[model samples]
Target: MPRGKQTDTKLTLVSQFFYPDTSANANVLSELAVGLEERGFDVSVVTGQPAYAPNDRRDDQPRREMYKGVAVRRIFSTRFDKNESTVKRMANDVVFFLSAFLHLLFKRDEMGVLLLPTAPPFLPILGWMLSRVRGYEYVPVVLDLYPDMAVELDYLSEDGVVYRVWDQLNKRAYQAASLTVTIGETMEETLTEKYGPCETAVVHNWEDGSVIQPKEKANNEFSRKHDLVDPTTILYSGNHGMHHDLESVVEAAATLEDSREEDLQFQFIGEGGRKVTLVRMTKDRDLDSVSFLPYQPVEQLPESLTSGDIALVSMQEGVEGLCVSSKFYTAIASGQAILAIANEETEIARIVEEVNCGIRVDPKRPGQIVSAIEHWLDNPDEMRAMGERARSVFEERYEKEEAIDRYATVLRRVTT
Candidate 1:
């Protein structure tokens, strides 16, 4: 690299995943890499092989490549079929954390700015080990506090040995970070309670407008191929896993069954641990009002979402405030109304209410979900108002321009 204006700050974004993967960590980190580079930072990335997105497992490919302007080093990791066994997934996490730590250990001699965020929650352990051995500038981004939130959500048991170990790693990662940034107010608050507000700051999420736009027609020949449509379409696109516990969604569909008077249709498009079970629940109950499909690329989101009259964002029981779904920003930017099903007290619930862009149904109450969806579908005028509100919220809070600027400012703050 030449000695440019950014020569003073040869920053490297470190994670176990990057772009070409549709996960939120990949999308956010990719944007951060490009944005920081544009803001006069000599940027590169140190990551693992493409362990996710567009691929079911860790791909057998070259160890390194460049995407656009970012220099990337893809280290080796245990093969992980994201769609496969839970044991394999855990093993992948262990390997990814160790490999990333080793990669950073070698980089520490010349490290400038190291940006480490979550994918495998223990990446911070790598950040800590690398920084302590050879002190380097680091900005720890906490997407979620492992074992803390996960344990709270019951994704991991409170007293599990792994959770206990991760709880220590979580504290150490925070203790070592020069500055910390989080994606939601709830997370910011949580960090404050632990680390105090001095070093941590709230940089709530924003949209990647580059890949998202108003695709008037979904253009999904698959929808046509399947012949699925109705009076109104309410689509939920993202993880359909255990944490999502989509039973209430199915129950809502069943509750609305007798009313057959309303033609509202629920479309679930994504993959997860709970998907098969969700499908079975919907099947055994014979709920004809809902449909399911596989995940798609981020680029296809606008088309997929705008194809419907409304978009849906839901949190499973006991999972509220654990994390914010990146899809909320996408759905908002799509200029579509969102029916957010979440606890009435969480950050997501606050967003839906503040945006006034859609209804907020008690996610635990299947009956309430049914009633809210019905009322929204039954009123076109209100729906249009909700869409406009949705767009307004996106422009004010979630647009790419705004988000990039926020990140750039934070980069300068932590690096300088």
Candidate 2:
């Protein structure tokens, strides 16, 4: 794990989404790839074109390019609307897997220490298969646990054959990985409890504090344009997927509207499967206080994130440890007080308690959410103090450089 030994190590990161794709996994992987390159490793990325980005932003990028010194190889895959249907999204995943597999197989000689992320869920299994064929060492980064999430969301039955097969495949992948990286301690616990012990590291997801630091909403362009400067905004920014308890938040918004809370506003920014439904609910209730906006560009993150007085982070009731929201890091980085809608056992809840950053309410509890919001509204000084503490905790523990360095250490340990 010496610095000198890292120069000879070649790392290839395989993910379905990468630069130009606005997905959370893509942004994290891209940053890691670039960071590793700067640390004297020959790093390359194999990723697909933009699928999660907005239509206007999803341009047809080149097949190959160099991004911030990291070699990027974009593979051809079906660009279906992921938010439209689950079947179409699966098809996209399938094509990307096959394309990535073939590309890696043909260039097997160039493959080195593989850094595979659990984006499409099949990527780690593909890594396991490739490592078997090429004798390459792979490190699987567990962003989301697959069958567990599916079962928790009630999308798949635990007694079903497909669930069993997927679970077994995941076991093989984790068992074969040189080192498995998880984003949170709860996730590490879940992995160990489910698949027994293995080489694991808990590297929390991060955001660049230098770029996403607190900004004044009065002077921020994104805030001004979106008319967020006047309202006491409670923002829910990020994916509105099934795993998130966003519907309950929407219901809370309805209650707040009924109570004629004019000064308070609920702003939902980003896209996901439940977006359409949330929009419909807002319309049906005629909730003028609730607003929806598309995902903003990365450059505007500072303004976009700081527009909120309180940031809402949630996960479905049963999916406490399955996945940790990356938005939590950004929310803290933006110096916004958090309103976590998750179980007390979850990582977000733990962080909220430890940092004294915000409040934690149970999932599907709209009444609790409303009460928490009211408390924040009444105690503005406490809310601002919590936001300050949140930013302090982010800088002390979850900054970008610290996380990238930890990943570099993990890679060097695995490769060496």
- Looking at candidate 1, the ten consecutive residues that score lowest on lDDT are 221-230
Runs of candidate 1 with Cα error greater than 4 angstroms are 1-5, 53-61, 196-198, 215-230, 297-299
In model 2, the Cα lDDT at residue 20 comes to 78
RMSD each, Å: 2.8, 1.8
Q: How good is model 1 by TM-score? A: 0.91
Model 2, CA-based lDDT: 0.87
lDDT by residue (tens digit), candidate 1, 1-416: 22244556777787877876667667778887877677678788877666664453544555677776777777778666655766777787888877777767766646687877877876766767777787876777777666676776565798889888877776777877877878888877777676444477667777766556554433544344445443477777777755564788888888787775766677898887778788999889988778887776565555665666687887765655457777788788777788787777767789889868988887677888777877876777898689788878787788776776787777777666
The true-versus-predicted C-alpha distance at residue 104 of model 1, in Å, is: 1.7
Measured on C-alpha atoms, candidate 1 has an lDDT of 0.72
lDDT of 2 by residue, 107-140 (tens): 7668788888987876788888888887768898
On lDDT, the candidate that comes out on top is 2
